[model samples]
Target: MDMTACNVCGKIFGASSGSVCPSCRKLLNIVYDKARAYLRDHPKERVNAVDLAERIGEDERLVEILMLEGRFENRGEDAEESDDDKKRKQLLQDLQKNLASMPQKQHETGTYGSDRHGARREK
Candidate 1:
């Protein structure tokens, strides 16, 4: 048996894996049940972490942790990507493309220099 600290309450306990202790894990199960029930009742609603926490009367942190644990998922219309999500993905793709081209661009333009004049001096 290994000892670890609970991420939620910061209590030390015996555990072999996961950052949370046994008590926190049990509480998380209860919270997960409530959140699942809420989701079932509001199947079409787009419920973020805060909203779910409010609906279930649980801490937003717990809801967020459950979300991170893959215990909760958006369903139906709520699962669809919003404009902001699309824009975020586009921005990420653009950034990746720019990063991916950096080496090639530097090679083509000979911009990778170690000198103050932007030129490599060979001895």
Candidate 2:
């Protein structure tokens, strides 16, 4: 029989077509379920693997693996973003709107060199 190390726990076990061992697979499934439920309850909350793992109290690595496997691909098209990100985006949009609504200043011609020296005499 062939032996291989489990991807999650690094435990050596009988080799199979899968990268993770049986025990680790079961644990991963539990984590996956928790992640799914959390995401479902908080649909509007953007989260990456690490944040999701922290919220669900699971290992970050497992969540990352599940993400890589496309388990959470179709939940929504919106990408994960933080509160700061949302704030920054809103600020930019507001700035754009403000700039667009403001009236443009009229340009005025000004003298280039030292005005203190003397004023140019027009012929």
Candidate 3:
């Protein structure tokens, strides 16, 4: 019999190919199903491992491990950005470029209020 320690619980058990034991694998499958169903119901919602685990009532480490193992697909990388998203990103890039190209103005001492005299300026 091939015996090994479970990755999640560190319990000695008989295993074959994977690092995780059968019990842990079953639990991970349940978590995976819950996460998948949640994502399916809320297609547009974005969640990290912690958030997903909280929402799905699973361990964050388990979620992260699943993600590392490619059980969960990355929507951001796989899906194309919407037209509005693309436009917004492009506009932001343009604004940043314009701002970067413009010359910076240095602030001078005694520029604003009281203009040399003690009296307050009008505008």
What are the lDDT figures for the candidates, one per model?
0.78, 0.80, 0.77
Candidate numbers sorted by TM-score from highest down: 1, 2, 3
Model 3 regions more than 4 Å off: 1-4, 74-123
Residue pair clashes in candidate 2: none
Candidate 1 lDDT by residue in tens digits, 38-106: 886887888889999998999999888888877765532254445776787789999999999988866
Better of 1 and 3 by TM-score: 1
Give each model a TM-score: 0.54, 0.54, 0.52
**Which residue pairs clash within candidate 3?**
none
Looking at model 1, which ten-residue stretch has the lowest summed lDDT? 114-123
TM-score of 1: 0.54
Model 1 stretches with alpha carbons more than 4 Å out: 74-123
How far off is residue 109 in model 2, in Å?
A: 71
Clashes of each: 0, 0, 0
